[model samples]
Target: MDKSITVACVQAAPVFMDLEGTIDKTIDLIKEAASRGAELIAFPENWLPGYPWFLWLESPAALTPLVYQNSLVLGSEQAKRIASVAKENNIWLLLGLSERDHGTLYMVQWLISNTGETVGVRRKLKPSHVELTLFGESDGSSLKTFTTELGVIGALCCWEHIQPLTRYVMYAQHEQIHIGSWPSFSLYCDITAALSPEVNIALSGSYAVEGQCFVIAPCAIVSEQIIEQLCTDKIKRNLLKAGGGYARIFGPDGSELTTPLAENEEGLLLATLDPASITFAKAIADPVGHYSRPDVTSLLFNPAANRPLSIKAASFIELIYTKQIVLPGSEEVQAN
Candidate 1:
C-alpha cells in the first residue's frame, strides 16, 4: 500500500428522488474526483435519490412509493453503472445508497474496488428515530471491515458512528481508513441542536480520535430546490433549511485534515492521508490494543449472517440406516 493517498469526500445534493439522474450526477462527480487524482471517493449516506427528508418533513406515506421506486437493488443495472464508473476511473468508491431487497429498504454503504468488484456491503444496524419508518435493520454480520490495497477500510452510515460498540468493532479490526457517511444536518435545525452540523461533525472527528484512524466524513447538501419540493408550507420550510453540508476529513490524531466547504457549498473535500500518521495516534491510546482491560469486560461479536431460512437434508447414509432410502434401480426401503 502507498504510504500516502488522496481521498475525496463528496458534498453535494442528489437529484432528489431520481435514481437515474442521481446516477448520472454520481458518475460525473466520480470523473471529476478521479481527474483531480483521488484514489478513494466517499459519498454521503443515502446519496442515492437523496435522504428521505420527506420522512421527517411530511407524511411518511406521501413519498414511500417514490423512495421505493428509486432505491438501488444490489445487482440492478443502476448499481452496475456506478461500479463501472469506479472501474473506468480506476478509483475505489465508498458509495452510500438506499438499498432495496425484495420489498424492504436498507441504509447501506457499498465498497467497490478499482476493478469494479464489490468488496463488501454493510447496512445500518439500527435506523435512528424517524428513519425506522422507511428502512429495515441489519444484523451483526454487517459490522465488518475489508482489507483493500489502500489499507484496512470500513464504513458506517450516519448515527452508526455514535454507537460505541460499533466504533469499537471497527477499531478492533484495525481500520486505517474509515468512511463516516452522513445525510444533511438541515432537518429540524431550529428545533434540535442534536441534528445540527456542529454536533454531527464533532462525532466524525471524535470517531477518528477514538478509533485512531483517518475519518472521511462525506455529507449531503439540502438545496433550495429540494426544500421547495418537500416543504409545502412555511413551517415545513423552517424545519428543513437549505444548505446543511458540513463535509470534513479528520486525521488519526483527531485533527481536521481538509478545510471545510461552506454549509451550502457543493464540492469535494480532498485530503492526502498518510498511513504512518495512524501509528503516532495509536501510540498514546489504542483502545483495542494495549489499553483494553479484557479481564473486566470484553465484546462478543457474532459475524454470522442472520438468514431467515435453513434447510436440513438427510445424508444418504443416514437415510439407508433408517431404512427409508430409495435407490435409482432399487425399490424404496421402509422402516422396520
Candidate 2:
C-alpha cells in the first residue's frame, strides 16, 4: 500500500486586524477544505489578525495600533478555539501568527494534531528587514520538527526559507512535510528588489527538491479593498497593490503538484502526496544522508529555548544545601 495523504495550502487575506473575523473566516475555510478530503492544512503566515503590512510602509513606532490590536496571545481562548476546530474536523493544522508573548511579539507557527493537542510552537529563527522592529527572533528550540501520526512535520515563515542553514537544519531533522508560510508578497515585492513571488516560488521548489520533502508554500493575498482601508499614505498605497495570492505545493522532486490560485484569488490549493515519493527522491540525493560529508562539515545546534525568567522552588533549593552542610560536633557528618 502506498503511504499517501491529502494536504491543503490556504490562500486568503485575513479580515485585516480583526481577530474574531479572521478566525471565523479561517474556520469556514478549514471546514470547506476538510470536506474536500484535505487531511492536513497549512495557513499563510500571520493568517489570523493578518500580517502588519504597515511595518514595511511606515515607521514601526507609528503602527503601534496595528500590532497591539492583531497580535495573538499564545494559549489564549482564541488559540483553544483553533485547536477545537482541528480536533472536531479531525485534521492536522499548521497555523501561523504574530504571537504576543507577554510584552514581546514573535512570528510563530503552532502545529495542532488531529486530537486538538498543540504539539509544537515554533517561532521564526530570524525576522527579515523591517520585521526586526516588530517581532522578536526565535531560539534554537524553535528550529525543530514534530513526529505526529501523519509524519514528521515542520514549518518556516516567509524568508526564513531562503536561509541555507535553516533549510539544512530542517533537512537534518528529516521532515517529511514542510510548511513554508508567507505574508502577502505585495508588501515586500515593490518596496524591495528580488523578493517577489517568483523568487519565493523558486525557493519553495528548491527546498522540496533539496530536502526531499513535500512543501506547502502558502502565500497571502493583499486585496485592493484592504489597501484602500488601511493605507493612508499614497506612496505606501502605490507599493502595496492588490493580487498577492501565490499559494503552491511541490512534490519531493521539485515538481509543482497543484496549479496555483490567482494572485488575488482566495482559495485552497489541494494536493495528494505520497510519502513513498520522498523515499524515491532521497534515494538519488539525501543531503543529510548519502550526500553529506560529516567529516568535512557539520552543524552545531543549540536546542535551548530563550526564557527571560526562571524560577526555582524554595524547597528544591534547600534540599541541595541540606546535603552540603553537617553538624560541627558530628565528626562523621563533617567528614571525611
Please identify model 2 stretches exceeding 4 Å from their true place: 188-191, 312-336
Task: Please list the C-alpha lDDT of all candidates, in the order they appear.
Answer: 0.92, 0.86
Off by over 4 Å in 1: 317-336
Writing each residue's lDDT as its tens digit, candidate 1 over 1-336 gives 358999999999999999999999999999999999999999999999899898887778889999999999999888998999999999999999999999899999999999999999999999998899999999999988999889999999888878888889899999999999999988888888988888998999999999999999999999888988999999898888899999999999999998899998999999999988998888989999898898998998887888889989998888887867676776776545
Best candidate (score: lDDT): 1
Number of the top TM-score candidate: 1
Across residues 9-104, which tens digit of lDDT does each residue of candidate 2 receive?
999988888888898998998898899999899999988778887777777888766777778887899989989999999998998888888788
> In candidate 2, which residue pairs clash?
none
- As a TM-score, model 1 comes out at 0.96
Return the TM-score for each candidate structure: 0.96, 0.92
Clashes of 1: 0
